[model samples]
Target: MNSVFIRKALLLSAVLFSSVVLSQTQDEVKKENPTVDFALEGRIGVAVGDKAVGINVGGPSLKLKLNGFKIGVGAFPSLLVLDGDAAPRLSVSPIIEYKKWMLITPYYGYDAEKKMIWTFGIGYKFK
Candidate 1:
């Protein structure tokens, strides 16, 4: 039973990795798969400092973005560390993203607990 859970977890990890790697950017998706109405995206970025929250600038942070919207949770505390702090700040944000014509997508969201913040980034999305 324990081995079954381990196998499932490992398989899930592989799927996520494959999605992130095989996914095409916005342009490609719009050009080839226009029929695809929504997408599931995985976001990976550096630990940019938050002025309002005073978070120590350090490593990378990963989050799941859905349908290009700002309604996702941070997927941190993985096997690899994404921040310098020992205890990760497991915060959730409900962001409102503005996807421009270009590849970049600018977002304005609050950390709810910390404060308001502005984030501009593009991520890999797949079906």
Candidate 2:
């Protein structure tokens, strides 16, 4: 009975020691390579294509940055000021940012005529 108790105690100690060592090594690895970051960004730009011409207002966008490049998606509400008439619609687009410049492509949305359109635009990102 005493031998069995000793074996169980040794096994528990070994498990605890290995777990602590593994956690410390993981923390060290994280410290050595801290390259990813996240941020909220907003942008405004003018878009014109097909039957869509408008001002894009994007905000509260979640961005993932790795190294020097950033990638994200934003839902932008566009104010279409076409032919002296104004209307509002939402567009979701993929955003690519480098430094302070932003690129929004395949800016897909519906026009005042309820027709699908694609537009692309460049703008500045606010930090």
Candidate 3:
């Protein structure tokens, strides 16, 4: 209820504040040092199921952002909580990211025993 709203507000505030701090520091660094070519990005999402609420946090994924095109790799894993029961899974994939307002990477995961699965996500580049 109110607590969920409060928590979301706090998380959003923290992200914005951090982004400002990072942006300022990065700007200063560029004036003093050569630009770096690497960045890390990730996604967090809430997954809904028939009887459960789940959470996901994936990637501090590494990428090479050169001339506005990025190529990278990352993994996604999630925990599902169902009426006190839990299930978990992990999938790894290579990703290709493009800059369009923000960075979006579309991935197709291929595990040795599993079929190829496709996923799409956005990334924030730091540095």
Q: Listing every candidate in turn, what is its Cα RMSD in Å to the true structure after a full C-alpha superposition?
A: 15.2, 22.2, 10.3
For model 2 the TM-score comes to 0.55
lDDT of 3 by residue, 26-91 (tens): 233244564775654556544333234445556556778887556666665655455577667554
Off by over 4 Å in 1: 1-41, 50-84, 98-127
TM-score to true structure, per model: 0.24, 0.55, 0.33
The TM-score between candidate 1 and the true structure equals: 0.24
Model 3 backbone overlap count = 0
Model 2 residue 108 CA deviation (Å) reads: 4.8
Model 1: per-residue lDDT, tens digit, 27-87?
Answer: 5423665765675444333222233212222123343556754343333221112233333
Quantify all predictions' global Cα lDDT against the true fold. 0.33, 0.62, 0.45
How well does candidate 3 match the true structure, expressed as C-alpha RMSD?
10.3
Candidate number of the best TM-score = 2
lDDT, residue 80, model 1: 17
Q: Write the per-residue lDDT of candidate 2 for residues 1-127, one digit (tens) a residue.
A: 1445445544554454345434543232334556976666666866555445668887557689988668888788887665567777677777776666666644555545666666656656666
Candidate 3: regions farther than 4 A off: 1-42, 45-56, 79-86, 98-117, 120-127
lDDT score, residue 68, model 3?
A: 50
